[model samples]
Target: MKFVKDGASDIGMKLHPFTLRFVDDQAYLEEEYRSYYFSESISSIRITLVLAIFFYAVFAGLDVAVAKQYQTQLWLIRFAFVIPVLVLLLILSYRPWFRKNVQALVGIGMYLTGFGIILMIFYISKIGLYTYYAGLMLIFLIGYTFIRLRIVSATIAGWSIVLTYEIVALCFAHTPTIALINNNFFFVSANVIGMLICYFLDRTNRRDFFMRKLLEVERNKVKAANDVLEQKVQERTQQLLETNVELKKEIELRKQYEQERTKLEAQLMQLQKMETIGTLAGGIAHDFNNILTPILGYTEMALEEVEEDNTLRFDIEQINHAAVRAKDLVQ
Candidate 1:
């Protein structure tokens, strides 16, 4: 009989908090998850960095073409700040050390990107604020798409950007109340939405990881059971082979015994025949001796009665001698 537990605990289910502060409970899965996350994020980081460079180049060119007053500052921001940070991220993505410190690297790269955008916003005129906001959205999207940060790291990076923006908007931009409220609402909403997406994405990936582990465990179990069953079958087959060999030996021995028994029976029959012949010969000799004894006795009486006649006496003696010889032969 198989015993199956019928509860969530039996299935290894645990209640996890939705807050970003809560760490994943599956400690055994950490290395495997890290490897997977690293491979995926590395490729994405390279692609996103390349795209960022291209887009920034295009924006810088457009600014030059339009003869914007802060074109030099824009170029400096793109080349010095943005390009260097992206290059650093690309370099780190290839390095083994980055895999060991993935969360930290991601958080640092995100902060650099956000800080670059904030610097651009500060330097660029108010009219170009919309363009910088668009750039910020792109950075946010890239964070969601490429970086794939853990819950704590993502929360830290995301809120830090938001706080930095709020402070910059208040102190530097010095915008009107209604516009500040609108910008805050929009940026906050965007951050919230991005956080939700990252949360769900991380959750989904982890769930799949757990599921794969479970399937692997089940497969191993089945393989072990099959191995045991195969071993038993082999053992049983070996036993049967041994039994068959023993049976063949026993059959050969039985046949040898039968041949010996037949030979012994033939010898016994020959002995019995010899015994019967000997008994018959002894009985005939006994009967012949009885007849010879009577004959000799009669011959002796006749010789005594014919004693006066010499010729008759000689004939009687001859008869007695012949009878006596016959009696000796019978004995």
Candidate 2:
């Protein structure tokens, strides 16, 4: 989900993704892209600058060595070719300011234009122009690939290929025989191969991103499901606690009932003992009453027979009184 703006002469060429822009903040997106752009630009600039300087020095030394032995036109052409590369290096060195602009296209255009000019000059002078052309295309591809501008990089690569083949046809058109292939042709061919490799790498990165996002989504789903399950477990645990409490209450109730039953059994035993004592007391009272009645009759008969003997009658009455007291005790 990105857009790529063509940095060359085509000002309107843009590559837009077929998706919604979820990033709501334009400033944030711009800043993020700018950081990446600058980082890559700085690295590329340093590398190209160092390489350009190195080549220039080497070419200058060779030119000096073969000044009298080789063509003057060749020396002058090689020397002129070095100037544009140096200018490109200078422009790329000021990458910080380039990021402050409205868009990255401005900086990209400046770089591409500088590189294009150098290659054009080299081609006209016939000084390994094919190699520089292929290198220029490679630079464009690498820049876009790192900065998330795939479409534009592809477009630049396509044009570079078309132009390279045309230049190749012209350069080797009337060659007598092939002794040693020109370094320019080899350089351009290698750059195309590198571009293909870069394309595959970009594709692999995109696939990896898709897979990672998918895994993240699945992980979130599992987390959500686990949360629900934990909630259910918590609810079931609460129910178990309530049930356990109820069971304890039931056990206490059973213990209370058992205690009441024991008390009732003791009370029943006491009642049975009382009933047996009442029956025994009634039987003893009846027997004592009969005996006392018999004693009273005998005493009365003795008193009547001994009317004259008052003392004997009194003694018999006392015996009947003592018998009555004994009857009461038995009752």
Task: State TM-scores per candidate.
Answer: 0.71, 0.47
Q: How many residue pairs clash in each candidate at the backbone level?
A: 0, 1
Model 2 lDDT per residue over 71-110, tens place: 3544444455544545554575576665454133423442
CA shift at 264, candidate 2, in angstroms?
Answer: 1.5
Model 2: runs farther than 4 Å from truth? Answer: 1-191, 286-331
Candidate 2 colliding pairs: 131-184
User: Model 1: which ten-residue window has the lowest total lDDT?
Assistant: 1-10
lDDT of 1 by residue, 1-331 (tens): 1111233222552325564231335443556667876776677667777887777777777667543787888788888887887788777777878788878777777877887777777765366443466667777777765667876687788788878888887898766677668767877887788888888887777676666667777787799899999999999999999999999999999999999999999999998998898788778888987877787888788877776757788877887898788777766
Quick one: best lDDT, which candidate?
A: 1
lDDT of each: 0.73, 0.52
Candidate 1 — which pairs collide?
none
Off by over 4 Å in 1: 1-15, 19-25, 65-67, 126-129, 176-178, 258-331
Candidate 1 CA-lDDT value: 0.73
